[model samples]
Target: MPTILPALAAGALFGLGLIVSGMANPAKVLAFLDIAGEWDPSLAFVMGGAIPVAALGFALAKRRAAPLCAPAFSPPTKQGLDARLLGGAALFGIGWGLAGFCPGPALASFAFAGWKALLFVAAMLLGMAAFGRLSRPAPGPAPR
Candidate 1:
């Protein structure tokens, strides 16, 4: 219950920030990506603003033994990049370029962005499920 409330609060705050920063809007994101035609540098400001805050958060987190909301800091175990990582990143970029919404903003847009956001979210979820199933190791024979 305690963990849920804080997580909810954090998510709400993040969604609010996305909305305020125009990240939840596909048109705005597309415009930002449109370097050849009508590029909007406003989102750059948002990224710039976020980088320092994220850096400070990381620095603070490094000083702490455990996170305030969890038992311990659980960072990514994977260090070096591989084909899976590169392929995943490429797919993510392609999806973002085509749909103008990555997972975070897509989820935020899902509330008020109507049918398009709904479709995107649905497709994203399906893709995630498919990946999970395909990536799972095959079952082996039980030990005697």
Candidate 2:
């Protein structure tokens, strides 16, 4: 699809951002999260830089003009904080704290060939697959 190009470009930029911001390193991320122990506040600056650009992009996208590929924007409509959402957030936070690697940073860090990142990515994909299986609809009774 035509949108794939833009998506790839965005992903490349995101990977580049992770690289440039030193987010691709688990030790850097761990240090950032360690407020009481040798903390690094650089991630705040990274978010500060990204937030304005994202805000401007959102503002522009909110205009009536057609989206780049699709006829219109299709943002998620969910607003409620359901159990699954909360549980997922908790799991994500635990994983982040334990592994010091989220999906974005883990993928980007592969360039450095870290075994921990490889394991983290593999486990993350397996968890996603497990969730997909658990979320699937149950089979109905056969017609008599």
Candidate 3:
């Protein structure tokens, strides 16, 4: 019933699912994105299978007072569409298409994909660090 136990179990299950669903394989993802080439629709099926489970989880979480292992739920605060949101989405899509990773599956793939996976993960972490620095508020008193 420890917090870390559930997290580790969930992460392992997710990695297994990614491997089984072929999401951990860059070739599979690249093929899915290559519409003009040897296109693959299997990734679509993988996503189709995940959406319902994710939606159900969200529905359940919304009804819960607090998570079983957490103090409270902290969902996204930004709801309005903005240039930052759009740009981030575009970056994510581009990264996914180019590297066959969107984080979860990337980390899951590390075991088999080796150094390529490490490079992608390194780049991802670097980008996240850069974004944190760049988006930080200026250290100054509030304007009157």
Candidate 4:
């Protein structure tokens, strides 16, 4: 209950932020991507506003041993840029450019976006499931 409550609150706050940022609207995102056409620069501003807050959050998180609500901090273990990473990033960019909704905004769009949002979420989940099934990490050398 304790863990779930914090997760829910965070998700709600995130959804609210997405709504306020205009990220929940695919048209706005598409417009931002359309540099040759009617380009909208609001997303850039939103990201600019978020950068400092995110940097501060990361700094504060590093200072703390663990989150106020969590047991321990589990940061990314991998740092190298490999083929699989690059390929996945390319696909993510392609999808974002075509659909104008990444995971967070996509989820937020569900309420107002109707069937197109539902279809996108379904496809996104399918892609994720496929990736999970296909991208098993190579087995390392057996323990000595």
* Residue-wise C-alpha lDDT for candidate 4, range 1-144, written one tens digit per residue: 678998999899889989999988989999999999989999998899889988998998988888987799778999999988899899999999998989999888888889988899999999998888777776579969
lDDT of 2 at 124: 94
Compared with the true structure, the alpha-carbon lDDT of candidate 2 equals 0.88
CA lDDT scores, all candidates in order: 0.90, 0.88, 0.90, 0.90
Q: Residue 141 lDDT in model 1?
A: 88
**Residue 132 lDDT in candidate 1:** 90
Model 3 segments more than 4 A misplaced: 138-144
What is the model-wide C-alpha lDDT for candidate 4?
Answer: 0.90
Where model 4 places Cα greater than 4 Å from the true spot, the runs are 137-144
Per-residue lDDT tens digits for candidate 1, residues 80-106, read 989999999999999999978988898
Q: Highest TM-score among the candidates is held by which one?
A: 1
Candidate 1 error regions (>4 Å):
139-144
Name the better of 1 and 2 by lDDT: 1
For model 3 the TM-score comes to 0.88
In terms of lDDT, the poorest run of 10 residues in model 4 is: 131-140
> Across residues 1-144, which tens digit of lDDT does each residue of candidate 2 receive?
898999999999999998899887778888889999998998888899999999999998888577878787888999988998999999899889886899999888887857878988999999999988888877569958
How well does each candidate superpose onto the true structure, as a TM-score?
0.92, 0.89, 0.88, 0.89
Over 4 Å off, model 2? 139-144
Clashes of 1: 0
In model 3, what lDDT does residue 120 have? 91
